[model samples]
Target: MDVHGTVAPGFEAVRDVFAGIVAHARGGAAFSVVRRGETVVELWGGLADPDAGTPWERNTLCVLFSGTKGVVAAVVAALDVLDPEAPVRAYWPEFTAEATVGQVLSHTAGLPFVDAEHDLLDTAVCAAMLARQSPLWTPGSRVAYHPLTYGYLVAELLRRTTGRGAGALVREVLARPHDLDLHLGTPPELDARVARLVRAPDYRISTFLDDPERRRIVERMYAGLLDSDELVNSARYRRAELAAASATGTALSMATLYDLLAAGHVAQQAALARASRTWSEGVDALNDRPLRFGLGFELADPIGTYGPAEVAFGHSGAGGGRHGAWPQAQLGFSFVTNELRAEDTDTRAATLLATLYDAL
Candidate 1:
């Protein structure tokens, strides 16, 4: 568990809070921190596979749902480094919305979901469907978590603009630049290493469906769909580039990414910076009601939305998985695990972060 040495410039309370989560979870995890583009902490503990008894190695990969969206957004940032006038419609004319290229990147596109409800998990089918849909809200008019649609929109836009999937483009752009092991789609060779999601005992769609507005929002967020057990633990999902959610990688890799981002080493894309800067921050009744987002990253507005807001920003995945955030003192702090706890977004992720704020 203590493979990596402890980092300082933090409170003892931070160490205790970290230890507390490790003790509570029953799976393997890795937590790392980088300050000003330098690593200060790299820690791992527990088992990678409780069933097979495999120790959680330093290379263990976890599925970071919405966190992966940040990875995809990084591609746009990379593109923006090269061109600022490039329109989202330039890449995806279908997206020639009132929303500027800046609006889409900022989660203001309002096309939070596919126009209608369907099983968008199948990437190819979903991609085809997305090509023909219209915007949900005027781009930049309001904020709504793009939820499942973010992946389809970004990936398609990337492909249309650059003639390459965001996954491939990301690899050519930032991933390779930083030596990150993150993958938009799971390489077939790594099929065996991917951990099956572990759902909570009481996780049920009925619990969420009983509410009308919650249903509407979730439906729009998920390609106009619903959450399901099948959606959580499927190999088919492994290769998907779920733009807003479903990015797969390790804590170490994600931390490395944030480290670069925090240092303002963001790609030389001016448009990407402007787009990211254009994203709405602060308390929005809808977006922050579930999770607060800024451009491709989640704002660590602890006092307002979920966690601390001392320059902290990153995304958390479904089922207790997480990665990245630049606190006041650090650029990247990662908390990744294979536990796949039932309470993914709000419940446990918030708990882990709250604990981190207290301890760090």
Candidate 2:
């Protein structure tokens, strides 16, 4: 594959690693890294839309998937509006669960699956249904990955506090000020720039149905949403404000967002530190993985593959998008791809990160 983009002096290894991954991957991907507020590496390659022959450009945008959590988390932490200890009901008066703002952000609130029938885009109805439902476990007592529900819950809190949706808040507070291309809702003009996702070759619902309880929980959280390519690729899905996983942007934009947050406003930096502190870690029974979370950010595991520094924080998408910052190193990096891959076996991001740190 002919990779495009530049690497600063001494960072050619990152380009080499990215080129190797793109050579083996079906779809295109981009990676960018920022150190001490300067961009060190920017690279992209392969086909953005394999069928139509669209080349992946520097600004090509792909769905961030769950990596959107980090974008939303950055905005939330930057705004520094919500009191972490305050009950969610304090802001949204109708919230029935006893989860504090911090608990909700940290995925410690056990309201993962909403048991009501409602349209996914109907934010009002969905939020109301979630509000009325009780948590499956005591809030803050254990960690359960909320998956789709986390976005809605956080969006409602953002709505109540800022009178704006996650997308709008992100646009006004993060994108505009920082001049980043990140967005929750893709504008009509940028639709052409959005890359079509290549479905995972081995993805099958049966793969996750091995355990009965896991099946039940997984189905409730991702049954229709994960399976429907039509729904995910539709215009409505791109336009609607689904904050949990609907974010779209290039690797540089994501890296820049993380970079700015690491060195920008005092409140934002403080919030990032607080949110990046280990909140929960271990085998998450719901996702059935040894996952860990800070507030809304994913932290580096004991192995530190997420980043070389233990203080590295960011989020990864369901497939192969990884974006985060090594705060102590004052470095931010992102690897985004349209090709879906099982997280367990995907080594693209880890390899690129390893090369990046080594180059540094």
* Residue 124, candidate 2: alpha-carbon lDDT: 66
Candidate 1 residue lDDT tens string, 255-313: 88877776667655354345345356533434344444556766655443235645566
Task: Candidate 2: list runs displaced more than 4 Å.
Answer: 204-210, 303-305
Cα lDDT tens digits for candidate 2, 104-141: 98888888877877677666677889999988889999
- lDDT of model 2 at residue 110? 89
Count of clashing residue pairs in every prediction: 13, 0
Off by over 4 Å in 1: 1-15, 81-87, 116-119, 122-125, 203-210, 223-231, 269-278, 281-292, 302-306, 327-330, 342-360
- TM-score, candidate number 2: 0.95
